[model samples]
Target: MKIGYGHMGTLTMVVELLLEELGHEPVVPHRPTRQTLALGAKYAPEFACIPFKIVLGTYLECLERGADTLLSGGGYGPCRAGMYGEVHGRILRDLGYNPQVIFLFPPLIKPYHFFKKVSLLKGRCSWFHLARAIRKAWTKLTFLDQMELLSQTKRPRELTRGATSKAFERGLTYLHQAKSLNEIIEAGHAALAELDQVPVDPAADPLKVGIIGEIYVQLEPFANHYIEETLGHLGVEVRRSIYLTSYTRHDVLSTKGDMSSRSLAMPYLNQKIGGHGQNSVGDVIRYAKLGYNGVVQLAPFSCIPEIVAKSLMPYLSKKYGIPVLTLFIDEQTGPTGIQTRLEAFVDLMEQRRAQTREGARMQTGSAV
Candidate 1:
């Protein structure tokens, strides 16, 4: 049986690796693009968010390519994400496609249920083989995350406009082709070392920006119009607040990292309001204290969690004296407009940095 899954940033790579290792043909559609967005948007309801539309388009492409089974991750909470698998499946059926849907819920909440669902895909692989596949898939995921972080650090400093990005793509290519844990580690190191060779502007002091919001919009460059690359091109350093590794550890393995998000957000947002809303607030507070120059919250239009978090941004900005720019996106979002806003934001950050340094000098003189 052929299996297909929608894109969730690097999660696609993980799913693809797992399916191949189990002796199943993984029918991954081409990466999400404008055409993918248009396809999904064509059939999707007007009110449905961009991610829904994108995933719908993805399944359609996969179905057309001969995939009979669909794999999707499930969520719980007030967030609409929990219903995507069911809703998307119905939409596909109504459109005349009869693909099988397998929605994998969070493993932590219901380990038995989660594994039972996963076991359905065991195909001809033995339990030992399945275990090995899981381990290899996880290794690839973590290595990819690390490579991405390294790219972010190098992007702003690269002397050539697209050098770091080009190297990053090459790194992903290497990782994607690796078949074993040792090979994955070697590929990661080789890729990082290649990035290290990209010429850099040692004197450049780029503005630092932390990205926080719904995981899809934050990680999927196509959805957010490649915001990270744009920021890097503008000589601004970018860091995402969430990555697949951290999410897996905290949510899947039940190993908490920096549980401080709850404590940090308590004053502004006291409870889990579904999705990553609380994390958004907490990330802003944490980044501000860590000396980041600014923060960008990228959320899809009509996203409840982010909308709720956006409401508290003004208060957080005032209290922390940090600038926050929230971009609400959908199929209608244009690259030109996003570029203009990013350029303006970067300029504002530069001005703020200058003013800060000047104030520091003035205070020093006063002390003398």
Candidate 2:
């Protein structure tokens, strides 16, 4: 089946792997652009989150590609993601696209009680094949995610530009070409090997920035304009609080790790915050304790959870003594605006750095 899907951050890569195994060709939708957002907005529910709009655009593009089906997770719970698939499906049907919808995340008829509503791909593939595919893709996805998180702490600046990306591209290339599980295994090793050697400046002062906000906007480069790279280009230390692997693992497993640890479980947010709520608060606090100078909270225009975070962030800033910047994105969001705000934030952090050192020296002299 020829299908299309949206970017739930790096999960796209893993899903791509699974689709290939299922012999279902993935017609990757165009990266989020002004056009993509516009098409999505046109058919999307006004109250639905922006990610829904973007996903609609993806399906619309796939229809243009003559795809026979669309695959995406059904957003559930108090969060908008749970119901997005059905909403988008109706929108596509109205647009005259009759493609089958493969809603990956079944509708949760009852909270903490899954309803098993995979109506589309219900009988398409063997259960064994589907489970195996998920296992393989998830295995690679978890390792890649953890490695990336570690890279952020161990060498944030260098990996930012093209190092981590180069490794990822090379790995994906190999993953695409693999015909056997052993081949996938070999490609993973090579990918990590390439990733392990990214460059970094040992003397660079850690001017940490916490990434928080909508999951889609937090991870998608096309939607967020390669935000991590923008921070790295300015020579500011980047502290990542999100990764696809961790998010996926959190979804399946318990977040029982330490809140005090720098890279501990995302404990601050066990209960879903109706969308990026707890993550926003946790990132701000996490960055503060990790000695970060700034936090960047991303949100699409009209996202409720992030909007909630934006409202309460003033307290987080006052409590932590760290500055926070909110970037509300939409079709009109350009790389220029993002860069401009990020530059100013980093500049302020630099001043904070200067003041901190001056205070340290003053204390020493007073002691003398």
Worst 10 residues of 1 by lDDT: 250-259
- The digit string of per-residue lDDT tens for model 2 on 1-368 reads 78788856557667777777777787866566668878888877676666777778877877898788887765556776777778777878887878887665532233233334332343467778778877888776765675556455544556356675676567666655655677767876776777666666667666778887887888787777878767866776565566766665554343322233223214434454566676677778777877878888889888877787788788778977989999998766778888998989888988988999999999999999
How does each model score on lDDT? 0.88, 0.70
TM-score of each: 0.97, 0.84
Candidate of highest TM-score: 1
Lowest summed lDDT across 10 adjacent residues in model 2 is found at 256-265
Candidate 1's residue-wise lDDT over 1-368, tens digit each?
Answer: 79988887777878888999998899976789888999999999899989999989989999999999998888776788888889999999999999989988887777887888878988667999999998999888888888888889899999888999899889888888888889987987888788878899899899999999988898888899999999998989999988898888775566233377767988888887777888899999998998999999999999999999999999998899889999999999999999999999999999999999999999999999
Q: What lDDT does candidate 2 reach at residue 224?
A: 77
What is the Å distance of residue 146 in model 1 from its true position? 1.2
